[model samples]
Target: MFSKLVNPKSIAVIGASHNPAKIGYVVLKNLVSHNFKGDVYPVNPKGGEILGYRVYKNVEDLPEVDLAVITLPAELTLKVFEDTAKKAKFIIPIAGGFGETGKKGKEMEKYILEKAREHNARIVGPNTVGIYIPSTGVNTALVVPERSRFPGDGDIAFITQSGALGLLTMDSVSLYNVGFSAFINLGNRVDVNENELLEYFGKDEKSKVIIMYIESFKDGKEFMKIASQVTRKKPVVVLKAGRTSRGGKAASLHTGALGGNDAVADGAFKQVGVIRAYDEVELVDYARALAYGKPIMGDRIAVVTSAGGVGVVTTDYIESKEHGIGMKMASLDEKTKRKIKDEVVPFASVENPIDMTAQASDDDYDGVLEALQSDPNVDAILVYALFQTPLISEKLVDIITKWHRKGSKPLIVGSIGSNFTMKMAAKFEENKVPVYMSIERAVKAIKVLRIRGKYIERWENE
Candidate 1:
């Protein structure tokens, strides 16, 4: 299923249009602009021409097409699918009236499914944004048509049920410079669900991490079966919606989704070793951290920082009453503590959360990081600084690069100032160190990393 969708040699766009604002036009534009290495036929009855390419009146008119993208209206979409079945083996229905709309829409969806089964055709969506494969330069997203040109190539495959949310999440995470192997928006998933994608990504050598934003699950037992197997091989992070009573009700009305009991899903996810995220922000947070951050061997976290307040906040969250993890603060040894006191100002605190004070120099920063990196008690280290301090930024980059070269443990940075922080954030990213704007985010990243490590440890023991 994935091979045909990802490696189509020829494709046809139904309901092709000339107007750039329409979804049909943007879909065609993205495919053409991204240099898709295949033949593209635009199908439209009223179309004279589009983007200098000749348009065929219908799918029957096209000579050969392996995949067909249907962008026609809901009422007329079935006819298009019937016509496309004769020529194409795969169909991506981008129209939005199926199951999401009410009773009539459900009937239409049933009809579409019957037609697809009759012709042995596979459908991607009836209400989906589409798919993107950066390596092959094939983008089928309706929103953000220009994202096809964005130089994104990484080992994470993301699948989301919400089309708009999926694209927005991609754009948001791309700001941190993380690339994706593939992005799939599975709207009103009539046939393809999270389990199939999970299995595919598990076997895909190009994918190292799998991230999903799911509103509901069709087959709970099947999802757990595949998710357990996949997480044992690679990390799987999920942001499950329809948790709250109100949200669950909204989910049912939104996509006719069956919102299962939140407690059951929670226990199921945990039993299968699936890392569940509380929100969308945490989903991406865990994705970036697990995708790039190194593994944590223990739960002893040491924080080194120039800002005392931020360090205190991070420590509070790391040991918060809400977190159930059994991580403890690893105190520095007497010798290391003594060295910090002797090498630095008398005002600096030499505790687990080392506050270097504002007067600390670049040498002081490097010294603290090196001490933490060498400390046997420290399983992971978090560094906090304001990006306006150029010396601190440069020193951080140098120290991180050096430690990374020496096989350092997970080192997380919490930067201040939105603008300057973004600049240094890119530097941390280049050095393979995850950076967070908030202390809470740093703690959450570490928490998920710890969870993944625990899961891996269990699997290895088994």
Candidate 2:
């Protein structure tokens, strides 16, 4: 069912329009313009051509397609679903004011759901932005691709509940050239929810890492079971919303989910080996680390930095036990220390948080990184590649990228600066080394990887 939703060869746009401002028109336009190699049939009450496709007067008159996307008012969506469900392989409703509204809206959503079951047609959403599969060029989002470009194909599969937020994250992620394999928003999931998609995408060949932005779990026990099984295979990172009473109210209003106690959610996630992210930034950070970088074997992390301040701050993050994450600054073995001393300047610190000073060049980073990679005591490598250093040019990106591709040890790069540095940072991302703008942010990603390592250990024991 999920495969049909993501891989439809022909799709009928039930509310397709020519108007540029309306969502129905925008979704059709994005799908058509974004190069979806499917036949697009536009249906509207008024029989007229929309974007050159002859519009069918009603859903009943539409030709059979692999998917039907409904962009009508909440009250009108059900009747359309009834007419099209039997003919279409999948149906997606793209409107809110359903279960999230109130008791009356719930009744309406229930009716639409019954029609789906009656026809045995799978549903994607009743209030979603739509599904995005860049590999197949299927983008069902209500927004256009001009202002917010779709992500290129990559190994991460992201799912979200909020339509607006999902689009924003996709647009932001694209700016850094970090792409996604597929993105689906489970809006007011009348029938299709995260569980089905999780199991389907868990085995997806293109998706190496799975990420989610969930307001609430539809089936808590089932989710926990599936999550535990999936995490042993690949990393699953989530950003659960509505932690506070005020936020809980908003979340409930947003998705009709009874946001429960935050502490229980946190504990359940940890037990299942699922990593939790607090915000959008953390969500993307964890996703990037899991998708591109190697598993953080242990919390004994070594920091090599051209900036002493960056080294100190990052070391603090590693030592601090935030949320019971027990991490330590790695102790460099003598062999590693001797190699670092011989390669770096004599004034450079040979201990943990190895500061090579501002005068450090690309050669200094190359030497220190090699030593850390060889040390059995150092489980992970964090390099603060301050691009401001005169001698450190574009060459540093390749050096870090090389170690990452070699797959001997996990190497994380940290470089914080203005736009100039961001361009340099994108180079590292392009090569898949996973560089971050801040030491704290960089260390947070490493923490998530370490947490996954611990839970994977439990799986191996079992």
For residues 1-462, write the lDDT of model 2, one tens digit per residue. Answer: 477788888889888877888888988887877688878888988878987888888887777888898888777786677888878888888988888999998998888888888888888778888898888878778775577777788888998888788888888877777878899998998888888788877888888889888987889899899998888888888889976443544664734344435877888898888998888888888888888888877878888887888888787788877743458899999999998887666779989999999878888877788777789998888888788878888888887787778847787778899987888887877777788888788888788777777787777798
Clashing pairs in 2: none
TM per prediction? 0.89, 0.92
Please report, in order, the local distance difference test score of every candidate based on alpha carbons.
0.79, 0.82
Candidate 2 achieves a global lDDT of 0.82
The Cα RMSD in angstroms, rounded to one decimal, for candidate 2 relative to the true structure is 4.4
Give the TM-score (vs. native) of candidate 2.
0.92
Runs in model 2 with CA error above 4 Å? 144-146, 243-260, 322-326, 344-347
lDDT of 1 by residue, 379-430 (tens): 8887775655544546666666566557476876777777667877767766
Residue 96, candidate 1: Cα error in Å is 1.1
Error of 1 at 163 (Å): 1.0
